[model samples]
Structures are given as C-alpha cells and as structure tokens.
Target chain A: MRPSATAYIYIAPAFALLLFVLFSPVIYGFWFTLFRIEYGAPTDFIGLGNYVRLIEDPTLLPTLSRSGVFTAACVVFTIIIAMALAVWINRLPARTAFIVQMVVIVPWIISAVVATLLFRWVFVNDIGVASYIIQLMGFDAVQPLNNPTGAMVLLVAVSVWKRIGYAVLVLLAGLKSIPDDYDEAARIDGANNWQIFRMITLPLLKTPLLLIAIVLTLSTFNTVETPLVMTGGGPGDATRILAMDVYERAFTNYDLGSATALAIIMFAGNILLVMSYVRLARWQA
Target chain B: MSTITLSSAARARATGRHFVPRLSWLWSGLFGCLVILNIAPLIWGILTSFKGQADLFRFPPAFVSFTPTLENYERVFLSGFGGNLGISLVNALAAVVLALVLGLPAAYAFDRFNFPLRRLLFLAVVASIPLSIGAAALLIPNYVYFASLGLTNTPIVLPMLYAAHQLPMAIWVIKGTIEGIPRELDEAATADGCTTFQILRYVILPLVRPALGAAAILVFVGSWNEFVASSVMVDSPSLRTVQPAIYSFIGFFGREWGPLTASATLAILPILIIFALFGRLMVSGLTKGSVKG
Candidate 1:
C-alpha cells in the first residue's frame, strides 16, 4: 500500500471514534436543540424555539452570570496563588522544592469527588473543622455551602484549591525553562529583586501564564463536580454554574431540548475562550 | 565599625548572593505553610475517616489524642462500596486501553506521514483536549442515543465515553513524544527493508513507551474520577462508580459521617498511591504537552 494509504489506515480507527462519538454527538445535540424533545424523543420541530427559550429563560442569565463570576474568581485566584507558589518554589533549594511539590500536588491528583467530600466535611456547620475554628474565634460558624454568596465563594475556592497545584507546576516549569542568566545579567546591571521580576521575569512568563490561564479557565468553566457535590447547586442556585445547570435541566427536569441548548451555549463559550487563547498564544509566540 | 563593614562589603563583593541564603529560608517556610494548606483537607479527611462518629462531632475537632477506630472502614466495606470501587477501576482501565489502542496509531500517523487534511485532523484532536465527554450537553445526546440503542446502564458505555474523552490527550501527548524521535530512524529501518508496521512496532513504540505510560495514567485517573456521565448514564446500583456511590451517601441518608469519610478514603486511596509513585511522570507528561503545544 502507498504510505499515504497506510497513514489513512492508521488514522481510521481514531477518526471513526472521534467522528461518531465526539463530533457527531455534539452536532446531533445541536440538532436536538432545534426540536422539542419529550420522553427521550423529539416530538415537534421547534426550529430555534429552544435557543429563543434560552435567551428568555429567567434562570439562565443569572446562572451564566454566576458561572462567569465563579470562573473569573477561580481563574484569577488560582493563577495568582499558583504564580506566587511557583515563584516561591523556584527560589527553594532543589530538594525541598521536590518535597513541597509532592505535598502540594496531592489535591490535584485526588479526584474532585474526594476533594469535594473533604471540603464539605471541613466546612460543615457546627461539627466541621473550619466552622469550629470560626466559632472558637468568636465568629458565627458560617457553613460556606449553605449561603448564597458564600456558596459561590466556597465553590471558587475549592475549584482553585483543586487546580492550583497543576498551575503551579506548569508555571514553575515555565520559570525553570527561563535561564538563570537572564536574572543574573539583570542583577549585574544593577536591577533590584522586584525590578528584575517585573522587567525580566513577567514578560518571559506570558506564554505559560496564558497557557495556564486558558487551561484553568476551561477547567473552571466546565467544572460540574464541585458545585454538584459540594453545594448540590444549593442556596437557591446561587452556585449553580452552567455545567450544573445543564445537568439539572437534563436529568432533573428531563428537558433534553433545554439541556442540549444550554450545552451548545456552553460549548460556544468554550470555543470563544479557546479561540482567543489561540490568537494570544500565536501573537506571543 | 561602619568603615570596617563598608570595606568588608567591598572586599567580599557581595552581589546579592549572601542575601539570598537568609531569604531562602523564609520563602521555604512560607511555601511549607502553603503546602500544608494545600493538603490539609485530605489530611483532615483521612483523620475523619479514622474517627468515631462522636469524635468527628467534637467542638474544636480533635487533631489527635482521640482513640481511632476501624469501624468506619468496616461499615464502608460491609455496605458493598467495594463493588463500586471495582466498577471505577474497571471503567478507568478499560478507558485507558481503548484510548491507547485508538490514539497511539493516530498520533504516529500524524507525526510520521503527510496526509490530506492531517493538520486539520490534528488540530481537531488538539481542540478536543478541553472537550469532555461528561459535559451535560453531550451527555444528554449520548443518553438519548445510547438509550435508544439499549446501551444505557450497560458497562461498556462509560468506558467508551471515557475513551472518547481521553483520546484527544492521548493523541497529543503521544504525538509530542513521537515528534521527538528522529525521523532518520524510520528512514534507516525502511532502507533495511523493514515494513512500516515493523518499524512502528519494533522501534518507535519502544522509544515512546514512557510518554505512552504517562498518557495511560492520566487517562485512567480522569476516567476513574468521572462523575457526571456515570451518574446520568447508569441507573442500576450495580453499575455505580465510587464517586456516585459516595455522592449517594449525602442528604437523604443524613450524612453518616464515619462511613462517608471512610468510603471516600477508600475510593481515593488507589489514586493517592498512584500519584505518590508516578507523580513525576504525571507532571512531566502534562508539562511535555503544554510546552510543546
């Protein structure tokens, strides 16, 4: 067989799966949104009714806004914390750096289910560790997951906590890839520590920073388990981000039409984020 | 004394290197505290797993000095979470094998051969990195489609869905590794009258073994941790993964703190051990994809 024929042969299985599984389902999902699905079947051709319903749906705009806030908070906090941790890890003695990383990365590797379970226990009212600590400090023992705004805050915190390790490791890898000579030369030129960090370090970090930002943004945006398990989208849907809302629409409401519509919107948001990242990444490169 | 100190500085020619040692300790300490904060929840959870129900309800929550018990573990195992854990393992393992089988060749073809729309196909797969099979949107369609096919609640669909989700990462990581190998090796093999299959099997596959292993571990972990799809697609109690099983313990059951913590611990122990053993490979695998891409 021709090499190209052979190559096509090699690619066939994966392409077939991706086509049938990923691409087709997404497209079929979009198709499903154009119709009214009832009892797991399309009953009527709605022809954009679902999309229009999405716009007018009272719950959706708030949910999107809530998800936006959560994603923004998570992306910002995770990047900042991870950046600081990476800088600190970069400065540590090599051996201690390894050990610190091993400890820190425990959260990232552990499943979100377990992480949420742990967080739920830690922040549970009255009998929980964090709540008890707060009570000891003479503050009201607030169950973070039980209040509206507090639920969003807790969700973002847990999301950040779960993912910060991966971001830190990636950022550290970026930092390490930058030669020490850049800082050395800057120092020899009479630059102070903060100045060197500002002028030399920050610019060089744009790629990894963008990489992590994009990655974190997507991960945070798509997060279902944190809100689902931790808050159960509780406190009146205050923490029900888009992913959770999608799940609720599908399974809870059995409204596959709305579910598909919301899913498409979410995927579009993801695509927009990814497209911008690609543009920025290209410009940086 | 001021003159001596100034002259000593001039003689020593300190270029901020001396200042580094003192501040290094401070940074290390700060990082130590941060690391503690990072893993604190897991530590607390593990402790709670060993605590009796009453001990878990302590006012300030005892960090130590309480008599630990295995009753929680006993309850968890007796409740048949072991079965749920088994499903999680099987699902994850099946997903890993399927991803490798389908993805490895795709990665190789993309790396080695010029084909029509290869870049487009490759870019499509790259984009798939952020796309999850467990997304509620896709899952809705999948639920309808699979239920129509009578595949819902079956054992294979979760792994199949998981493999689809993992295929993108598998392709990207393996492709990155394959690109690193010298093309000259393939050319030399061809010159020696080796077929393409032989060259791939004997030479390229072995060379990319580490990357493949890393990808497999990542895929497995991702599959193992999956919740949304598993919850939606599978209805039978026997089909429940550990995550959904753990989730089931909340709310209506009034939170059996001991059994809950114990079961959560049991569910995560394998992943924790894997992370401990292969953490470096996992980190390198992730970095390898990000940096190269």
Candidate 2:
C-alpha cells in the first residue's frame, strides 16, 4: 500500500468508531428532536414543536438561567481558589510543596459520584460535618441543601472542590515555567508583592488562565453528577441545571421529543459559551 | 559602594534559589487550611465508614473513641454489592482497552500522515470533547436505539459508550505525546525499509508508552467514575456499575450511614490505588493533554 493508503488503513478503526458511535448518534439525536415520539413510537413529525416548547415551557428559562448562574459561579470561584492555592504552592519549600500538591490531588482523582456522596454526608443537616462545624461556632445547624440558594451554593462548592486540583496543577505548571528573574528583578526595583503580581505575574499568566477558564467553564456546564447525586435538582428546581434537566426529562418524564429539544438547546448553549469565551479572550488579547 | 550593592544582590539571589517570591507563613497556613478542607470530606467519609451505625448520629458526630465495626462490610457484601464492584472493574478495564485500541492509531496517523482535512479532523476530535455530552443528551435516543436491538441492560453497552466518551481524550493525549517524538525517527525507519504499519508497531508504539499508560489510567478512572450514562443505559440490577450501585445504597439502605459510606469507600479505594501508583504520569499526561491545544 502507498504510505497514504497505509495511513488510512491504520486510522480506519478509530475514525470508524468515532463516526458511528459519536457523530452518528449526535446527528441522529438532532434529527430525533424534530419529531414527537409517543409511547415508544414516532407519532408525529412535529418539526420544531419540541424546540418551541423550549420557549413555551415554564421551567425552561429558569433552568437555563440557573445553569448559567451555577456555571459562572463555579468557574469564577474555582479559578480564584485554585489560583490562590497555586500561588501558595508555588511558595512552599520544595518537599513540602510537592507533598501538598499531591495531597490536594486526591479529590480530583476520586470519582465524582463518590465525592458527591461524601459531601452529601458531610452536609446532612445536623449530623453532617459542615453543620457540626456550624454548631461548634455557636450557630444554628443549617441544612445547606434544604433551600434553593443553599443548594445552589453547595453544588457550586462541590463542583469547585472536585475541579480545584486540576486548575491548581495547571496554573502551578504555568507558574513554575516563569523564569525567576522577572520576580527578582521586580523585587530589586522596589516592587511590593501585590505590585509584582499585578505587573509581572498576572500578565504572563494569561495563557494558562484562559485555558483553565475554558476547561472549567465547559466542565462545570456539562456537570450532571454533582447535581444529580447531591441535590437531585432539589429545593424546587433551584439546582436543576441543564444537564440534570435533560436527564430528568428523558428518564423521569419519558418525554423524548422535549428531552432531545432541550438537549439540543443545551448543546447549542454550550457551544456558544465556549466560542464566546474564546472570542472574549482573543478580543482582550 | 555600587560594587558592594551588586555583591549583596548576588548573594541575595543565591540565597533565594528556591524563592517563590513573597510567600509568607500566613499564606502557607491559609493554603494548608484549604488543603485540609479539600480532603476533609473524604477523610470524614473514610472515618464514618469505620464507625458503628450508632456512632454516626451521636450528638456532634463522633470524631473519636468509637469501636470500628466489620458489620458495614458484612452488610454491603450481603446486599450483593460485590457483584456490582466486579461489573465496574470489568467495565472500566474494557473501556480502557477499547479506548487505547481505537485511539493509538488515530494519534499515530495524525502525527505521521500529511493527510487532507487533517486540521479539520483534529478539530473534530477536540470538538468531540464537549460533544461527549451527547452521552447524556442521546440517553433517550440511545435507549430507543439499543432497546430495539436488545442491547439495553447488557454489560457491554455501558463500556462501549464509555469508551466512546473517552476515545477523544485518548486520541488527543496520545497525539500530543507522539508529536513530541522527532519526525527524523520515522524517516530513519522508512530508510530501513520498514513499512508504515511496521514503523508504528515497532518504533512509534515503543516511544509513546508513557502516554499510553497515562491514557489508559485516565480512561479506566473515568469509566469507573461515570454515573449518568451508566444509570440511564443499564436497568438490570446485575449489570449496574459501581456509581449507580452506590446510588442504590441511598434508596435501599436509606439512613444506614455505615454500610452506605462503607460502600462508597470501597468504590473509591481501587481508583485511589491506581492513581497513587501512576500519580506522576497521570498528572503529567492530564496537564499535557489539556494545555496542549
């Protein structure tokens, strides 16, 4: 075989699987959205009926906004915490920093479901750890998952907890790659810590920050396990982000048409968010 | 006086060899507290799993002085969660194998072949990372499609779906690592009259083993952790993976904190061990894979 033909032969299996398993299913899902399926049958060609439901449905707008709020909060807080952690880690004595870095990685590597379940136990009203801490501090025991705002906060915290390690690691790698001369030179020139960070560090850290922002935004947006396992979209749909919304619609309600339409909208929304971030980053650059 | 200042600055630079500019004890303590907070929940779960059921609800939640019991383990095993554990192991292993088998070659092709539409195809692979939400999105459609073919409730379905979900990352990681290998090696192999397939099988494969290890570890952990699709795809009790099985503990053993947590602990322990064993490679691969593009 010619080299190109040989290359094709080598690549055929993966491409074939990707095509049939991923691409085909996605295209099929998009097509499935245009028709109403009743009782396991495609009962009518409801071209855009389900899509129309996205606009008409009462819960749709609230759910989308909730997802937006959740994603935005999760991304922002995760970046702050992780970046702080990274900056600190960067400062530690070498051996201690390595250990701390490894210690922080446990959460990221553990299963999300397990992490979610663990947090559920940790915040379970009075018996939970957070509440226990609250009681220790002379406060009333609060069920963090009992209200919409509280539940949303808990979900964001859990997602951030799961993801902070990755962001820290990424940012740490970026932080390490910076030559020490920049900071030392600034220090010698009478720049204080904050001034050094603002003038020298932050500007150079933009690439990794953008990468972290994009990845964290996408991961948080696609989050279903945290909400599903922790809140179950509870406190009156306060935490019913789009991923969970899609899962509940298809599985709980068995509304395939509505589910697929919602899924497509979500898919589109995610694409738009990612593209906007890329554009925004580029524009700022 | 200028020479004195310069010498002092040189001495300061030498002493500051490991300097991470302006990190103070207060900042270190704050970071330490955050790290403790980060791992505290998991540690609490582990501690809770070892406690007797009565200790879990004790006022203030017992932090110490409770007899750890084997009863939770007994209860979880009696409830047949062991089989679920076995299924998770098999599913994760199968997913890794499938991901690597499908992903390595694609990575190789992208690295070696100057094919048409290569950038577009690479973008498609990268784009698929976000699109794997299709795993959740196509749950209903996949259900209908598989249900019609009698594939639902089969052990194979979840693994296959997970492999598909993981394949993109596998390809990306492998591609990034393979790209780092010099093209001169490939040219040298061709001069030796090795065919393209021979070169891949002999030369490229050996060079990217660390990446392969990294990709496999990732896919294994990811498949093991997957919950959404596993929950939606399989309805049979015997075929469920550990995540959904853990969810069942909530429903079946409601308020039974001991066995429930014990089960969750068991679910996490294996992955934790795998991660510990491959910590460095996993860290490097994860960072490399995500930051490359």
**Candidate 1 per-residue C-alpha lDDT over B135-186 given as tens digits, one digit per residue, 9 for 90 to 100:** 5446767676677678889999899988988888788889888878988899
lDDT per residue, candidate 2, A125-152, as tens digits? Answer: 4687788788889998777778888888
Q: What RMSD does each model have against the real structure?
A: 3.4, 5.0
Clash count, candidate 1: 0
Best by lDDT: 1
Query: Which TM-score value belongs to model 2?
Result: 0.92
- TM-score, one value per model: 0.93, 0.92
Model 1 TM-score is 0.93
Docking quality tier of model 1: medium
Write candidate 1's Cα lDDT for A1-285 as tens digits.
134768988889998887776777767778778888778788889899998988899888888888889989999999998888888888778998888887777888887888988877876645878877787899986666667978878888889889988888888888997899999999899998889889988899998888788888887888888988888898877788888888888888988778878888888877876665554443110
